[model samples]
Target: MTATILLTPAVEERAPCTLPPRLVLAPGETTPVLIDGAWWPRSRDLTAELPALIEILDPLWGRITRVTVNPTFWPVIPRKVPVRGHVVHVGWFEAEQDPHKLLLLSYTVGRWDLLVIPPETEPAIAARLMATATDPSRSLTATGLIHEAERFRITAEEAVGSDSLREAVWDSEGGNDARRPASHASAGAVIDHVPSPAEGR
Candidate 1:
């Protein structure tokens, strides 16, 4: 199935916030927000909290064609491949009217995917499907968790190396120096305690 993946920067709980005024639920209008790629609460009170979240995530949602909430994942039993993959399911809702869709929130895992539905009612249906999602935590044995943690460490190291290379290239291309500025006098200073050959003789 076709899906769009959106990556959000790490969420900081202490960051400032802003949101829109809560909307009265119309007969056919619905909004939902996904928290860590999962459906979050979508009551009138919860929707009212969207404005503050919207402020923090203003940069991210600007490019989004639409926002969705109550995302679900279904594990695909591999037929030919030995590994299983998860399919993302989502409910589409109007970002403006749905406070759930506008909240700037963070996830434990650093990434989230929003599935924009062409039809608004799709989200409500997706929410039901999401209720059946298998808890990823439950699937991971202790050993699996350990292995995954180790893999993450290795990935982080590789990322650091990649960043260093990029920085070096940028510096070569006259990019801003990341190092602290050095004083001219300090750079030019020299030691002067030499003796002539004749004096030594």
Candidate 2:
């Protein structure tokens, strides 16, 4: 009997593609808000990241002419970045701009402020922060939203730790430890007292 051997082809590694910007905008209202929306970027590289953001916002908010960021968060800031066929000017400020916020200026639309969620944030925590930041009813600023996110993350970790400890205790004794009451902590407690938007300014 003759056995046939088949050679397997090696799969080629592909370059990583950019993800769509994780952005959420607040409901439009007559009154201006401290923050217009929130953007969660995948990296700190402003040059590499700005094009995708501009492409998404250009049509909805008008042609974005200028964008500004704080030097603290972004490592390298290019003077100008080309998006589509036009050039978008990039500016950086230390004292004037908030580290957690990005300011965008458009040709048709006036100015827009967005909460810049950190690149390394957990998905759950980032989602909560994005929702809160864009909430029209909430007067929290970009900084305030970040503070709230941190608090929420810490609380959630504590809750998980507590749950594990309880499970360990139950395991040590019998599985049917009916006498012990179940304890649950709420993560929403931190979001209840969001600071006024003015605090961030």
The best candidate by TM-score is: 2
CA lDDT scores, all candidates in order: 0.31, 0.76
lDDT of 2 by residue, 74-193 (tens): 776667776777878888777888889999999787999999999999999988988888776778878888998899888789667766765555444445554544442233333344
Clashing pairs in 1: 17-52, 18-51, 18-52, 19-50, 19-51, 19-52, 20-51, 53-104, 91-123
Show model 2 residue runs off by greater than 4 Å: 1-17, 176-201
TM-score of 2: 0.76
**TM-score of every prediction relative to native:** 0.21, 0.76
Each model's total of backbone clashes: 9, 0
- Model 1 TM-score relative to the real fold: 0.21
Residue-level lDDT for 43 in candidate 1: 29
- Deviating ranges (above 4 Å) for candidate 1: 1-137, 177-201
Per-residue CA lDDT of model 1 for 1-201, tens digit only, reads 322332322221222223332221212122322322223323222223333333333344331222234222211111111101211122333323232222222332133332221122244443432332223322332223334444755666866776676555455444555353444224223422233334445
Indicate which candidate wins on lDDT. Answer: 2
